[model samples]
Target: MKRKISTLLTFLILSLLIIPSSLAHDDQAKHDADLMCVFWGDDKVSLSSEEKIAFKIIANAAAITIDQYSLNPNGRIKEGTFNEIQEGLKYFGLPELSINFNDIDLNIKVSNDGKNISPNTHRLYTHLGWNYKKHPNNDFWKKRKHVLIDSVNRLLFNSKKIFSWFPWASDVVYPPSEQCDAFCAIIYYVHIIGDHIAGDTADKLKNIEPLIHYTSMDTPGIIVELKEQLQIVFQEQKNSYTFFELDQKLSDLTISIEKNCDILGFIDTAEKCKKNQEHAEQLLQILSKHLPTLLKNESFFKSRFK
Candidate 1:
């Protein structure tokens, strides 16, 4: 009887020790999966070697644009910077974007003096970040999220479709207008290249749902708040914000969510909530750092191809 009781006690202790560790590992795996969904979406798109190089070049250009805007939000972009992007695209045989003067839907218009043209404020705001549109239904946020996923899908595959608007206008002048600033130029450049940089992977891409569906299955309100904040800041402020400002707003929202995670009682514990918050912040950091880092190491990226 004594031996049996001792063995039973040992078994109970071992179970207690092993079960938590196993749970922790499972939690970590879930966090990682959630982060992947936020960044890459549900479908996995693979890039070829040549396509990787093209993606890098375009990403670098975006990084350069972000860096410039962060430094001087109101300054004019350098002609050389624009030329470098154009040359990089040409080297990769990607389609160059020309202004579609016939497209009445384009947000560009003649200046007050009628001697110059430029993208309007609304265009600049929408291109640089998210924009809010009022809808009568509750699916507005979901639709907006779908738009983001679709843009990423186009970036990864079906890039040619992005440039199909003016496939034959190769010799057309870039900048479309001399009055283009950093905001106008970079937005135009990204819109053109984001579609085609993924090269021949077009057919393999798939549509994905919002990050909320994947990351915050238990508490989707948090993700909705995040999306709402992003749209409100850009839509209401016009063209008066910078990347750093936006980052702070997002960081604050994350922190608030972290604090309320336990009080909300949706997760198993405060520790799990904290871990999820950390993963979300990490995703934000990756986005904020990716472009600037690529631009800073532009030389290294270029040497890799050579």
Candidate 2:
């Protein structure tokens, strides 16, 4: 009996040790999957200041919508605002302005009903304690990536249609349609393509600095930097299709934008398009109005040109 008891105790001790090891292994696998999903699939939309304001309303509406859906099937929790808004903004490619997490309130109205909030819109909200370092196979991540692609693709497709017919769209105020579309389309195309490409790279790198270092630069500078990097990527890949043309177009537009500024100029004619382009156009106009005068009047251009 004494020997049997000792054996049982030994077995119990070994079992306890194995259990935690198994759990840790499982958690490591899960973390890997999550990181893979973010790396290969997540492509956030970059927003200008005006766009951020507009999209905040959209994000809030989305949160409410998701909450309402959860109220039906899943019960609601008191919306503990965590890095959620910033995460969303970061995911959406907004500049992470110095807005403290404590200040931004994401109040989730929980109805007395028994349904829980759905986690489809953003996995980050659902998995709080998820580890992001370990990657085993990418199966779990692939599914998550598909979910995100479907969601963002729909929004982007719809955005293109709505923004094309905005009220502000006019021939005289904005550039011509071909020109405007070229600009708008390039932004959208780059967003989708670049995010898809860069996101995966960022995920593997476990940092966004390689893809988009928001702190080191502002919007225009970032755009220029990204353009140069992308040129190198395409060149390295020896891609002869859309890659070369897209890179050139973006480069040309960036340069054109830098060269001429017109305050009266606008980028969008429709209300449905994203506001960032409009704001960009507005900035260009301001520069155009001020830069020429500053240069010509002050003999700045003469001195430089001479």
Candidate 3:
């Protein structure tokens, strides 16, 4: 017998928020799947560990309806129109119910004014296409309804750019800080991952050349690794890094940083304002702990490609 809607939905919500990779990893078919991890500098939620958990939970909840609406833009569901925002959310295979956008604890700001956030004082639900009659110019609603999911998703998950810990808001200007060094380190880590994924015969590492430039320019020699291993991943093409091997290599690299945070180049007072070393330490911790768990999840790995 099939599980009830509530049971199925709980699983979907949990998988989407808590462990996307874990569930995908269990699927043997997706074992060889490869997707580069996404990253971003601004337009992302960067905060402490506890804060991230809360952000993911609420963000996912708040965007559920949008995700569903985007997939089926032609019309409403079932025999009725989408009257409730919760109803739209439920269409995304969510078994439970509608979510309150107000509960999302985030610091998103308007791109233009930089003072306002969505789903909060903005009341995103009311603007959705469900209340089509409310809008005189229905094109705005039509466009928004179609791309709602991705607009939100990009703020959280971006594969095109390297992720950063730098605090950003539209209005706030950040001074030169250690976060730059930390970002440099992560870029090199991604570069090395790209090297292995590309293998020796191919010259695909060019994709990360920009990353390499930024890392070397920012911290100069921050990627402290054994010369032999460096050549293996970079110079040698025959030895391509498989996912498990890549995970092990990434683990080693992060652990190396934990052992020596100086690889982040934080001795100088130039960018020495705040949290550079401390943030680098945090990155090492994330790589050592969080990254390993994420890599092990086959589904999450593939989603990176998607």
Compared with the true structure, all predictions reach lDDT values of 0.31, 0.29, 0.29
**Which residues of candidate 2, in runs, are more than 4 Å off?**
1-217, 232-235, 238-241, 262-306
Candidate 1 lDDT (Cα, whole model)? 0.31
Query: Taking the tens digit of each residue's C-alpha lDDT, what string does model 2 give over 89-155?
Result: 3343332223232222212322122234233222222111111222222233333222222223222
Question: Compared to the true structure, candidate 3 yields what TM-score?
Answer: 0.22
Error of 2 at 56 (Å): 21
What TM-score does each of the candidates earn? 0.28, 0.21, 0.22
**Candidate 3: 10-residue stretch with minimal lDDT:** 28-37
> Per-residue lDDT for 67-117 in model 1, tens only?
221112223323233333333444344443332212112112212232222
- Given candidate 1, what's the lDDT at residue 226? 44
In model 3, the runs with Cα more than 4 Å from the true position are 1-88, 96-99, 105-243, 259-306
Sliding window of 10 residues with minimal summed lDDT for model 1: 202-211
On lDDT, the stronger of 1 and 3 is 1
Rank the candidate models, highest TM-score first.
1, 3, 2
Residue-wise lDDT of candidate 3 within 191-290, one digit each (tens)? 2333223222222212221111133332223233312233332332224443345446545655654454454333334233122334333333334433
- TM-score winner: 1
